[model samples]
Target: MDRTSVVEVGGIAQFIREIGPDEGASPPLVVIHGGPDWDHTYLLPGLMPVSLHRHVILFDMRGCGRSTRGLGPDGYQPEFVVEDLSQLIQALGHHTVDLLGFSTGGQVAQLFVESHRRLVRRLILASTTAYAGGDHYLVGWQEYERRLQIRAPRPAWAECRHGEGDRGVRGTVQWALDAAPIAIWDLDRLDEYLALLEGVTFSGEWLGPFREGRLHAWRPTNPEQALRDFVGPILILHGAQDMGFPVQVAQRLHAAVPATSLRVLDQAGHMAHFDQPQAWSSAVLDFLGG
Candidate 1:
């Protein structure tokens, strides 16, 4: 799994990874990760388990993680991100694929399917939003501090002490770890969960735009208007208590898309797959296989 290849689109290089069996699988699952700034590393274990059932392709959005970085706001446009994935699929020799877009990645997936409807087979929208009417769900420090009350016990905090190293990567990691009680409902593997997130790599460039108010002001021209033409199965997998996007956002998305299966997993938050790995993976497999 160490070997990776870059798929270039519009001269911007995007990183791509593949795992699990390619044969005897439904359409290959292509995953677009979260964080306009986050890389694909934090989605592991939850996603890695799905590989046992089928081939999974995970890619870091341009300017995030191991891909090309330091691209300013203009370069991180939504269309550009969609183009990168478009060419990435072509580069992988896949005509169509089952897609999973988590968090911000889910927004990218929705837009991509709208523009390239025929290239998608099954759609899984996990912990994401439609961002309609130009809504960029940004959380404030006060609210962040409020969210911290849900953080795991002090022992769990010690597991991710590495998060306090530096302002860029470390701070971002600490913030995420601080939101643990919201992330991991089943505190059984708290140490393993923190370690996995701490190990996930990140890029400073993606954060610069967010803090500068550049990325937040941007929105898709037509998130659902374009989707009116796409007549395919969409699985809306969201956390029952997702404070980040709220379950209502997922409800709206499912309502707008005529053909959608909504699965609200109990005891899960914004990161449903992380909170309920077994249930989440099984739900994904059942939907994709159906």
Candidate 2:
């Protein structure tokens, strides 16, 4: 059975959800969702399939989702997130777990794995990039723009910036609605992705900075070295058609980190799990092993 509760970690109330058994042979898989603005709900059903094989743990980071909020800029730092995950894991009575982070959450996973290497058994980076300042950074975005022009050509909200006028979760939701063309490769499946966002709580405090280009500010001291030094195996799972991080970025990350195994799902966009749930979950299950 799945359970949901709030745990106080690092002096903040963190909302956590768990699926499958707590004392399974394999360690629990702690998943971190992307969007400093997005909570953990969107990954449901799409990510639920993995619960059949191993326990799944999902939670919202500080200032996002149903967790503690309103701390403003200082509370949103990557260090705070890394620290919270560490404390939360210890509080949950686990010595090790398989870690998966999606999009920006993957970035947080990177930091967490590096800071608490002994706590993570395996690392999965889905639809996320290790470094945002590299020269290859623009590849996915440029492709996304090209695809958007061809697919969504002059959408009604074209003139407005994402989350424009609106603040908090609604603003991010608005941005996601506007960026649907590039978010899901199969235009027909766009509604499936949107359906998951229904009633999601967003943090305007976090969204405010995210909208101002703060998402790119996350730069690990030396990601390649950190991944190389990681104690467990790493998986780079991404969408073949992802315009945000692009397949090329995954390729580059794979080449840099010899320990990483790369999996690219076709007909999927940035939200590969939403687009191809079976393939996405199967890949994760296979990687975790029985």
Candidate 3:
């Protein structure tokens, strides 16, 4: 059975949505959505397929979506999010869970695993980077835009690429709108994926700090070294042509953690789950030993 409710966790109301069976041998899979600002809604229909075999949980972190918003700068820390997930899991009666963090969510996952290592049975980091300061990502994005220019190039590409203008939410949204089409490798599925994010809401309060790179203050000084101590197995799943974080970052992560299994889907970009749903789901299910 599917269910949705508002669970008060750590004095903050969190919007939680669960799909699939209530009783099962496997622990529930708690998924963390990307965007320090975006809610859990955009992951729908794409990640919903996993519910067929396992109970899946998705929630809006503190200041996003249906969850409580307007928490000043102090309440929006990454550590607070980690603690929220920990408390939320216990409140839901889950002793342990399989966790999947996508994009920026994956960054939070790293923080989660570091402090709450024992709570996660297995972890999946998708479309994210281990290196907090992504120097290589800039080079990959240039190539991504070059390929995009061949098909459909927006006028804002030049300005957005250099980070020359304002760094406010307006500039951020404009950049995302102009470049979103090319973020997916398969142009055919672009509209289908874009449709999922319609009417989506973003937390400007959170974005203000996030855009300034202050939200990730909890990140380890050396993230690659930190991954070596994780208690559970990890799966680095990414799209070969990802424009945002880039697949090479995933490759570097895979190389750093020799125990991790890496799966890269071709003809897919940042939203690989939407681009290649079957392949993406198969990889995730197989990794969880389903």
Candidate 4:
């Protein structure tokens, strides 16, 4: 895996990891990570199979991961992030490419495709939804928060209340706040994930803009319009048990898109790629024609 930085559309430098394929391979497939706030590390291993066929490009979106941060209100808006993706594609000199977006990143990708249909060859939306307005979608968010609270660091009340001086409490608290939700399979990965989160400093500037932008709320007032607008082939993969962005959301997205295929993994939850890598990878590979 070769790591480097590239100047993308938003005047922001993007941190990218390029995994080159065997000699004389095809153009790369760009993998977009989820989380309006999360980074690219979690999606890396799951995409190895796609990398086997072509070069794989992974990057940190603005205000997330190893990418340049502190851009104030300009950085967090979903439109700008889509622009950033467009610029990155141009910067890389690719006229058209395969794109795979997970969770929130899928929303960004869908917006991008809606705006620039010619640039996308194949589209993959995994563990994501079309509109965020549905009640089922909020279930996922609530579950995420509940799980987060459980893994949160709790110090003795006396230490915090009396200021008894336990320095470790601060670190633990920070860990709980920034760390991504853990998978049941890998207990040790949480530490590594926490370390990565600590490395990327976040500016609260995007918070206000994010809340105002309402990027989390997906209300496609004109689903028919969106369907009529985009003509690219799309693949929708969702976990049957996903608490965040329930399976029904994926179904809605599939129903709306004119050219789409839907795959629901039975026993998986929110993070299908992490929870069921083999199944996820096989679906992606088959869709992309591996």
**RMSD vs true structure, all candidates:** 4.2, 3.8, 4.8, 5.8
lDDT of 4: 0.67
* CA error at residue 233 for candidate 2, angstroms: 0.6
Model 1, span 235-255: residue lDDT tens: 889988676777778888778
Global CA lDDT of candidate 1, please? 0.74
- At residue 252, candidate 3 shows an lDDT of 89
Q: In model 4, state the lDDT of residue 175.
A: 38
Candidate 4: where are CA atoms >4 Å away? 8-10, 22-26, 137-149, 152-205, 212-224
* Alpha-carbon lDDT, every model: 0.74, 0.80, 0.78, 0.67
Candidate numbers, best TM-score first, in rank order: 2, 3, 1, 4
lDDT (Cα, tens digit) per residue for candidate 2, span 1-290: 68999999878999999987666788999999888787888887667898877899999989887899888655667778888989999999999999999998899888887779999999999999987644354555665657556433333332343435544655666666667778788877655555565546655667666556554445378888888999689999999988777788889999999878999999888889888999999999999994
| Candidate 2 CA-lDDT value | 0.80
Better of 1 and 2 by lDDT: 2
Off by over 4 Å in 1: 1-3, 23-25, 132-147, 150-167, 187-189, 216-219
How many residue pairs clash in each candidate at the backbone level?
0, 1, 0, 3
